[model samples]
Target: MANQASIETRDVRLWYGEFQALKGIDLDVSRGRITGLIGPSGCGKTTLLRCFNRINERYDYVRTEGSLIIDGHNIYAPDVDLIELRKRVGMVFQRPNPLPISIRDNVLYGYRLHTPKAERSRGAEDEALESALKSVQLWDILKDRLGDRATRLQLEQQQKLCIARLLPLKPSIILMDEPCSALDPDATAKVEELIRQIAGEFTILIVTHNMAQARRVSDECVFMLIGEIVEHGRTEDLFIAPKDQRTADYIEGRFG
Candidate 1:
């Protein structure tokens, strides 16, 4: 229960055309915790994150191997449904990409898409919208402005809205790819706090280039290099006493 893995990868490998992006990754992400993936550019951290929801398969030349299991299901199995998988494993990108529609519409878009028509009454939709916005601490500020265009909101508000939009789908896992990278220092701190507050309710896997951020937000950390994992351990231990020299060197700023 408490210690079980929500996401597990066994010797997972991936390639984009002739280029290998991931090479034999084996990892387990604990349920109801924050696991951060940190490494230099081109380290395949983001590639690995996208694998959880099978988004990387969008490219025609992209190919993957091995098993990626979420809960007890093998996501790469031929019978797996991509839409349902995505709904269960939501993603928040580096930049805020809210829709150009009204704020209320943006928050309810995913709900409307996945929910049955009979269950999408206006009162139900409004309730879902408020709950989602409150989860992201946006309800207070945006409650009266539901009809405003979402894209016109401040970057921080838009980013929070993007996360709010995912809640109505009732995802069990949340994947964040440098979610705070586009925000200012103040905004980044706020979003990091928000992530920490939501950790116990959903499994979170975040890809970050900022070592400091990894130290700050993650309960566990995985360090990767050139498509291969170098070290995986508790964040405090890994930062204080990394067993591998490459991990130590990278953390010490000796090399990227």
Candidate 2:
């Protein structure tokens, strides 16, 4: 069954300085399901993804003119609280960025930003941190080495930890921008498994160049072209029986 709408963009448009990046895209990402955003380079997939969490709001002359709604709240509104929206719509970047602190401190960093630790009891923060790590299958590996520097871990492990850090806040949706682009096959498989395991708990929207990775992880897929979505449907039909020639061409490796 098609899941509930987790995020919806209506005629969304974005521009940087004088150049337009996203050209009035209208897309819906369903809750509790993985949605893939695939297109050629510079097709605005990442720009469109950044809009969900208001990440583009910081860019000068990056004006947007359409409604971008998350959980019934219009994020583009001037009155919208960006901090709250960002906390709810956490993002994982392509590269894993662990802070220059200990492993335990890295997980606690975002928590400190969102909540007060001193006001809470002794075990509350650590409990939440551990729970998040366990959810991402990193607790076992890092438990004994919590005092170690985050930069010391393997690249893949650090990436998973970056994801683990977000879980402490209990985000309703996750925005992943080519999160597995830098990982090897083994690491990518592990992250994919983690995504599958956590899907029903939180809505996930990913932008990727890897068609197979999208096919493997996403329940629904959107194929974009030149800043416009050409097709979107259940992954099986979209891949097996694409409606558009462009989609077929991209899927069949005839062209990107």
Candidate 3:
């Protein structure tokens, strides 16, 4: 399949109060691929990831300039619907945050919210729940435990559940902010495997501090510094032979 852009940004800049978090970011994230954003702390990796769904605008003083286009629609347009935009672009946080409700409920929460009540029959809900859990390799383990509270699962399971929930919504893009930061080595490996398995099905944009993980999971990598992109290219090219000195230094551990 030909690689197409799932997301496009032109001169995208964001500010919180008086502090500029992202400065003139222009990027094209390809469809059905994993693009990793890597940089030192406070480099605005998380801020740029949040811009896809306009989550930063939640704060009253937050301001954004320039256009952020997703799936041919400019999300910053006045007539855009925030609720629908979020459904198309899902997010996984640094930590697993599941609802206090049953596992079944958590999986169906977004589906129920976005889907019309008249079309949500018991059979359809069951199908969606099972499909989502199976996609994340949780169906065999959690199918019997669907009645249990979601928060009662293991940390790794919780994070996988978070990803599964998004699948039911059929999101075109999924943004992950350090999704494996909370897991142990073994759990991280399992989660990374899951990410790889789902790569060609959805466009994934991940912000990660783990260079090894970025190299392992991403097809393309983007390195940022102080709210600006320094380099972006194929993962191997960026790591083995970077085009920019800043990228080389960071990859070589000379400096963050």
Find the candidate with the highest lDDT and give its number.
1
Per-model RMSD to reference: 0.7, 1.6, 1.0
Off by over 4 Å in 2: 1-3
lDDT of 3 at 234: 92
lDDT (0-100) at residue 194 of candidate 1? 91
Q: How many residue pairs clash in each candidate?
A: 0, 0, 0
| Candidate 3, 1-256: lDDT as tens digits | 3465899999999899999989999999989999999999999999999999889888999999999899888999999999999999999999999989999999999999999988889999999999999999999999888999999999999999999999999999999999999999999999999999989889999999999999999999999999999999999999999999999888888887
Alpha carbon lDDT of each predicted model: 0.95, 0.88, 0.94
lDDT by residue for model 2 (5-86), tens: 8898899888898888888888888888899989888888998889888888787788888888888888878798888888
Better of 1 and 3 by lDDT: 1
Tens-place lDDT digits, model 1, residues 157-182: 99999999999999999999999999
> Model 1 TM-score?
0.99
